[model samples]
Target: MYSFLQVLWFVLIAVLWTGYLTLEGFGLGSGMLLRRVARTDKERGAISKAIGPHWDGNEVWLLTAGGATFAAFPEWYATMFSGMYLALALILIALIVRICAIEWRKMVNSTKWRNVWDWAHTVSSWLVPLLFGVAFANLVQGMAIEVVDPSNPMTGVGPENVDLSVHVHNLTGGFFSLLTPFTLLGGVMLTAIFLSHGSLFLAMKLTDEMRERATKMATNTSIVSTGLTAIWALWAQFAFGGSQPLAWIPLAIAAILLIVSTAMTLTGRVRSAFFASFLGIAAAVAFIFTVMAPNVMKSSIHPAYSLTLWDASSSYATLSIMTVVAIILVPIVLAYTVWAYYVFRARISVEDVTPSGLLPYKIRAGENFLTAN
Candidate 1:
């Protein structure tokens, strides 16, 4: 049986991931929509203006989640990082490019410069979600893992020869080896889900023509997203060994909520639609962590090699210290985040700011400014 600390940390890690997905989902979705749904430079600016303030902040959750995993479950972290280094590197690069695009959009006055950055932003945005989807799906499907003893070790003389057997290790075969049908399905579904989420977000944050286009996109994408999500969740239920009955229960509810979200979007209830989408995403996250519990990372090579909560966790003392630190800091972070959103909470429009190629890029007061332009 796992100790209280182990379970708590697992739940905390899951919460961090959920926070990342929920907060970043719309941002990624909005980025993906930049070129497709946004017809004019002003419309694209409205999209960028909608997500600019929160996008970087949203990524902090991912960093926190990764850090938490490293601290709480070093073994799992070690294996996952080594196994998926290339894939993670790609994600990091894409994020860098996307940030450059967002930051550079207003820096230059040339229409060609603005156009180039727009496409760059759009491409990077799509890549982030697509890759993340694939990565998360791989987590659900499990990775090929094994534990082995190091080949060389130091020996000491303590009355006689003493062997140091302190190091224990887990290994993986890298990200490419993890691409399977189920995981691919997961990637596709999440991409669709985020696209739908982005559309809803744009609808809420934009006005007039932009809002109408976003609403239409949200309605259309939600259908595909909901369908794919349902199928993916159901596949995990029947095909995967680790999935639990309780987990499937929430997934079923999430399906219903997603459908409701779609309906609400179609009927022009933008706020309600967005809320439903949020709830659905939250529910899906809950179900995923529920299924992944006990085992932080499953081993496709052999069940015995799996990294269970007990095997992956740090020492009790370490956990206790981290728990205290988190308890003190998490609330402060949350409060500041909430306040930031509240401060920037207002609809954005093309009229709210000058066009991309304008001489001086400037935003009106009380709006979340993307560029110094």
Candidate 2:
């Protein structure tokens, strides 16, 4: 049986991931929709401003989740990272480029400069969530893991130096091994959900023509998102849920909420739709972690090689110290996040957005670039 600290840490890690997905989903979605939904430069600026105040803050949850996982499950972290090194590196690169694009978008007055940054932002936004979806799906579906006996000198660890009883579970699959039909479906499902969530957010936070466009987009995407979510959730639960029958509870809730979100979007209830999508995302993330508990990483090679929460956890003393630190810091983070959202709760419009860059420029039909006040 696992200790209370081990189980508690697992739940806490899940909460962190839920927070990240719930908050950042719309931000990434907005980035993806930047060019598609907004025709004019001013319209694009409004979309960026809508998410600007919270996007960077929202990323903190992801950082915290990674830190917690490293401290609480060192062995799981090591093995998963070793197997997923290339994928993770790509994700990191995409995130870095997206951040730079968002931050540097208004650094120049030229239209070409902003256009290049917008394209970068849109591509990276799409890549990050799709890659994350694939990663999470692999967690549920299991990986190619094999147990290595140190007693065998051929296994790399010298028999004379290492204990014979110590065996390590290592992931033997390469990057190509991660791609499969089910995992690809998972990636598309996540991307669609984010698109709907973002459109709903824009519908709530914009006015006039932009709002109408966003609402129409939300209504259409929500339907697609609902259908895909149903297929993916059912597939994940039935195919890879193992002995955890109770995992169906959160999965059911996620499906229900997503349906409600779709209905709300269809009826032009922007605020309700956005809130439902937010909660639905959180519930979906909860289901993923729920189905993955006990076994942090399932081994496809053999049942005995699966890494359980207890087998991968830190020492009791280490957990005790970390728990103390988390208890003091978590609440503070929550309070500030809530406060920031409340402060930036006002709606935006195209007319409300001023010209971007220190010296904004306009191009006439026959003239060269001209500075605009």
**Candidate 1 TM-score, C-alpha based:** 0.89
Name the lDDT of candidate 1.
Answer: 0.82
**Where in model 1 is the C-alpha error above 4 Å?**
152-169, 241-243, 356-373
Candidate 1, residues 1-373: lDDT per residue as tens digits? 2399899999999888888898899998999999877898878887888888998888889999999999999888987887788888899999999999987887767667788999999899888887888887777777876655456423212312222244344554665686888888888898899999999999888899888898989888988999999999888767763446678777877988999998998888988999899889988888787777668787677666667888878899999999999999889878877987898889998888666453544566765555434
Off by over 4 Å in 2: 149-165, 359-373
lDDT of 2 by residue, 221-329 (tens): 9999999999998999999995789889999899889999999888878899889899999899889888888899987666676788888899998888989999999
Q: What does the lDDT come to for candidate 2?
A: 0.87
Q: Which prediction has the highest lDDT against the true structure? A: 2
